[model samples]
Target: MAEEEEEKGGSKKKLFMIIGGVVALAAGGFFFMGGGEDEVMAEEMVEPEVVEGEVLDVGTMTIVLADDDPDKLRYVRVGLALVLDITADSSLVAGRVSLVQDAAITVISEMTSGELRGAVGAADARERLSTAAREIYPDGEVIRVVLTEMILQ
Candidate 1:
């Protein structure tokens, strides 16, 4: 009976040691793998503070334009419609109604049919429109510029 008791005690000691080793290895691997470094660095990179005057109340706007020629006017209307739909649905212009309207008009006026279809043309248009809107309304920040429509017939 005494021998049996000693054997059980030894087994328990072995089990405990195995569990402890596994835990230590897991902890060591976690630290050695640099798993937490990214999180630490991300937390350290803070956003810059915005002074009170620098902040702007951005808004969205809509505009409609038509050419004198019937065919051209129809194309313009289609383009305008596309622009409106895109701008209205845009997540970036959710609260900026005035900016969206101004941007749509500015983009449409500046765009040629070829430019509208070319590679990187839409991006250029968005950038130009956003810049123009910002200049027009310096008090309002334009977060995004969307192309809702392009119709040139």
Candidate 2:
């Protein structure tokens, strides 16, 4: 009878150990799966809050510059589009609009009749114009300099 009682007590202890192990395993799984309220709250606390800024609308400007020829005095009209980068600091980007326009004029004036005639010439002129615009707004980050209208008369 004593041996049977000892065996029953051993079984009960084994069952308790198994139950404890299962409970521990379940708790571990819940925490690892991000199921606990504390875990969810920690994630929410760590996430970055987004703040919105005021939007500034930049305008496009068109400029007409006379060619180098004194007698004919041919003029080329170019339409340029400008947009301020919201990501960039506002103070730096504010004063570059006029500089970009002036640079475009300077670039167009340098083009000769020979340079403007062929397909290669037009491409080269465009690159030169882009380079000039970039130079003017070194920090301002000019997105694009579009030559909408090119007329030589």
Candidate 2: tens digits of C-alpha lDDT, residues 26-126: 99998788677886788788945333333323343333344565776555545655443344554565566667666766776666666665677667766
Clashes of each: 16, 0
lDDT by residue (tens digit), candidate 1, 1-153: 999999999999999999999999999999888788888898899755432222232333333344444455323332211122221333443455555455566666555555555547666766676566556435443433455554445
Q: Which ranges in model 1 have alpha carbons more than 4 Å from their true place?
A: 1-100, 137-140, 148-153
Task: Report the alpha-carbon TM-score of model 2 versus the true structure.
Answer: 0.45
TM-score of each: 0.35, 0.45
- The candidate 1 region of ten consecutive residues with least summed lDDT is 78-87
Which ten residues in a row are the worst by lDDT in model 2?
49-58
lDDT of each: 0.52, 0.61
Candidate 2 has which clashing residue pairs, if any?
Answer: none
Give candidate 1's error at residue 34 in angstroms: 34
Q: Give me the overall lDDT of model 2.
A: 0.61
Candidates' RMSD to native: 12.7, 11.0
lDDT of candidate model 1 versus the reference: 0.52
